[model samples]
Target chain A: MIPKLNIVPFVSVDNMMKLVLSIGVERFLTELAEVVEEDFRRWESFDKTPRLAAHSPEGVIELMPTSDGTAYGFKYVNGHPKNSRTGRQTVAAFGVLADVGNGYPVLLTEMTILTALRTAATSAVAAKHLAPRGARTMAIIGNGAQAEFQALAFKSLLGIDKLRLYDIDASASQKCRRNLAGFGLDVTICGSVEEAVQGAEIVTTVTADKQYATILTDNLVGSGIHINAVGGDCPGKTELHADILRRADIFVEYPPQTRIEGEIQQLAPDHPVTELWQVITGQIPGRRDPRQITLFDSVGFATEDFSALRYVHSKVTGTAFFEELDMVADPDEPRDLFGMLLRAAA
Target chain B: MIPKLNIVPFVSVDNMMKLVLSIGVERFLTELAEVVEEDFRRWESFDKTPRLAAHSPEGVIELMPTSDGTAYGFKYVNGHPKNSRTGRQTVAAFGVLADVGNGYPVLLTEMTILTALRTAATSAVAAKHLAPRGARTMAIIGNGAQAEFQALAFKSLLGIDKLRLYDIDASASQKCRRNLAGFGLDVTICGSVEEAVQGAEIVTTVTADKQYATILTDNLVGSGIHINAVGGDCPGKTELHADILRRADIFVEYPPQTRIEGEIQQLAPDHPVTELWQVITGQIPGRRDPRQITLFDSVGFATEDFSALRYVHSKVTGTAFFEELDMVADPDEPRDLFGMLLRAAA
Candidate 1:
């Protein structure tokens, strides 16, 4: 079909998978990481706000919106931990990218897979700055849906060739290992969190409980190791112990939001933390010393989603991975919308 | 094709026009007015918030969100008055309705046509309680895209048969007069706003300027006339003179929002105004006397959009007015999202 002004390109779940597999997931993550870093370098131009969330007894739904003056983007995402038990994905998402000039959407895409890729890309980008030099081994606790993506992103971006996976459910760890078997990674399924973190240079904790459970205690964390904390994203959901948070130099994306939703929520309200953008722009030092522990509080921000959507929009330009959706109303004479309807009747 | 678990029903602009024309615009407005009134009766059960707006030099884009404990709905809309000159709709919108329990969107729809229908339906519902008894003649100022819808709604719900229309641009008024010719309404194109309001029991100011333009001055508004102010919907954008507002008992959709966006912005911060919901629920009288000038300062509320989306969701069930959209990802095993990608490669 010929594209029209009222038509927005839509990336469905099936087409999104085709896009990822066609581009190759590792190459996509590596390229997306470069885009994420580019946006972080110019982060001051963005209009930022904390994600608007509506909490419920079962789960929470959120709208994350941001604009860079020319383009506006927002993601509609939900996190329901109990959904997995009922044959549903624990997290599901979709997003829209629109023109700020005319307020018409240009692209709409399923973001469940896009979000997974962006989160892992963001983690790898932060690790590129904060992880110890020549880091080779990485341990990921809570090997659920996001585990393989994180492992692949590290392998592509930082040359991390060894993976130590651990989960409370052994099948989850086995699934992670099986998924990574052909990816040239030395994968190991550890029986305990202690065994998972034993000689690893980086530790990623991404559990899926909506409570104040301490997946990483202070005793489990050692100096000179970088920690990626991904699951402590809402008000009452946290994954790290307060002792580990107090000891580590916490790096966050948008402190106003991370203060309420990230690992720093366990710290004092006035506790000092450095923004990751400053580190990306070289305004602040990333890893001060080899013995210092760096923790990236990854609650996921709007700009990261904006960067991912922007990347997808560019890649889908000449590709058939998206279908045109007749979304906005376009009247020949703007003031004659009623006349347009009347003509449609005829 | 059978609907999958992740498929969401999408109503496009073409489908929306078909649905509206299928239902007959007058009957649709009357039924939607009933739904709007029913939702207003239980206003306290909703989680309401002022729209999250991103303002720029061009115009503004906003996300208006609300939830009724069981369902959540939001509209993404834009207002750029200059867009009409470039052959674009000055106001364009779309919305989504989701299940609050799992935070999954059940419907996605083009809401530009839906917004016009809902705004007209809401005004008629409010005027049903506020306008004088046996009101027949209505005047519409600024005959733009919404004018025809407003005219038909009053005709269907309030027994209005005579319309005196005025616009700064004469061609717009002529277009409005032409659109309503076959709708069984006696329509006249007036030369000025004063002539339009002459001998009219209800006057609606629906101009589209983004600045403070007084379409209705103090002398233009007479006693026993209900003023439906529809165009002064943003900060620094209003349609009435302060003198006219001072002499009128203003009613608003939501006080906090209307105080910033409605004509009431010209009034004092503590200016007393009644909530329209209270009047609809009979907690307060709508019009105390025939000589009282009742002003409905409508900036449009999220709950109105929520009610409109709910109404559309009900009307489109099992109808050909919608298509199934594969927007959400559903993995067979929720934790094996990455494995699902791997299998897709096969």
Candidate 2:
């Protein structure tokens, strides 16, 4: 008989999708945002470090690990911008949550979908704290895999019901428009970044490109808008012009990491930036005035992934959304690992 | 239908044991040693780094990652010495091997068994280079979970047919003696570490303790013996006395890592040590003199794990020792990841 300790609850892509749909994407985003906010409120309790990255010509792979004294979590993610040409995701990920007391993994799940959910939820949380008051319109400047999720998250979390979408590839915007159809939001497919950001209170730049291509130019971004900079997450991959970063009060998740991978990578190492946790914990003010531009230089952090895993672990109980994976070796006698192997032959 | 890209080959604990048994433990160790030696020979071609460790009051969890430009691999391992009291293995591990070209994981396997195999094989490989001419007897000071594999590896790889086993817990030594009863070797269960090391050419210290407990004192370690120090693998955890280390010419895998986590951790940071790869690659001499003591301070390296994964990947090609897991999400249109989740609801 297989030992219960050896069985890790594995959430596959299908099961994750089912779980999201069952809870409804809006509700999932709201709940995930709350979890992320709770973790942010207690940020000093986590063991934080810059992610370990292995870069290649095509892309990079990274392992992000963090523990909150009780549970340890890590996400294995790869980003290959060129993967889309071969019908593969530009980003794919999986993560594990383990018990810190015994150093045993309790949950193993596909994080590609969860990452999407958490990224959007994190954007919504930031917008709630920093966006201009009574903001109702968001300009999604890159209508790709993350566009609709960001749209729904903003709509659900902050009551933003209008979206202005634009992508260099027109079909991507059409796809986003089609996906968000009848979701109780007005989605306009724009042709240019200028048109997308026109009269918008929130501008999200989430384009998929390996190079430092400016999806939003300095002149295009106006005052008082909360800029969610998502695509500038790796070295040499910024989506906004440097001038825009210079003009905005940057709020980031983990300054050490954001300074390397976020839009602030273009700035000096000692450039002043506020940690988002400080804003969430009320240690610092988010927006000083309605005319002040607040940029959440969002380069997804490990704590958000930890919170996502925590949320999934809580929701997956008494549900069939996960399968048991026999990943660990369990012997009746701890020292009899060899004997267990020998006995299995019989 | 599930996409081909989504299916990652998974080798469970049971399958790993079966594969090891089918190949015969002796042959497996020999082959694994060869793979490790080959990787060591070409060490300059691979990326290397110190393992990232998260330490707690109980134990530690670490992530060891390395890449050979073409393929990337990492192992997730934990060492909790107190876990044995709860009928759990002191160490547990799992690993993933991914393609660098596309950043897709090709294999995910239970590394608890493979780690045991590779560690023993690595010891044998080191012994092959550093041990005295025609060394026939090995004194194993800790007859625990790793003892049998270490004994068999030495016996098979270096033609060491005699064994002397000792442990503070006599049942463990008795268990080792009983396990290797019919394996074509003379096994003696000794009462003390001094008795075990009597007349033996090689001494292996592999006890599982979280603290700096000396299992081998300097008085017992005579000249001309090759010591394989395996248990002192983390900070503040060592098996050999500082005097023993001072008396021996230490060789290590990745000096930066060994200086922090190996037996040499007791020595100064600038203490001279030889890289094992140099010896394997014929860049440096091994077993310099008959009277000189050589110690292989093995803290386990990522490249060795890479070689183990490579070896398993080669052998499991046409075998049913693995199951395909739906770990990666493959969308019909890669940019439509949110659409994939939305369509799943319908």
Q: Judged by lDDT, which candidate is best? A: 1
lDDT string for model 2 (A1-346, tens) is 1258778888999999999999999999999999999999999999999999999999999999999988999999999999988888889999999888788888989999999999999999999999998899999988888999999999999999899998989999999999999899998988888999999999999988988887888899888999998889999999888898889999999998998898888999998999999999999999989889999999999999999999999999879899888888998888888888888877
Q: Which residue segments of model 2 deviate by more than 4 Å?
A: A1-3, B1-3
Cα lDDT of all candidates, in order? 0.93, 0.92
Q: Pairing residues by index, what is the TM-score of model 2?
A: 0.99
Q: Which stretches of candidate 1 lie over 4 Å from their true place?
A: A1-3, B1-3
TM-score of chain B, per candidate?
Answer: 0.98, 0.98
Scanning candidate 2 chain B in windows of ten residues, the lowest lDDT window is B1-10
Query: Across residues B89-140, which tens digit of lDDT does each residue of candidate 1 receive?
Result: 9899999998888888999999999999999999999899899999999999
Interface RMSD of 2: 0.8
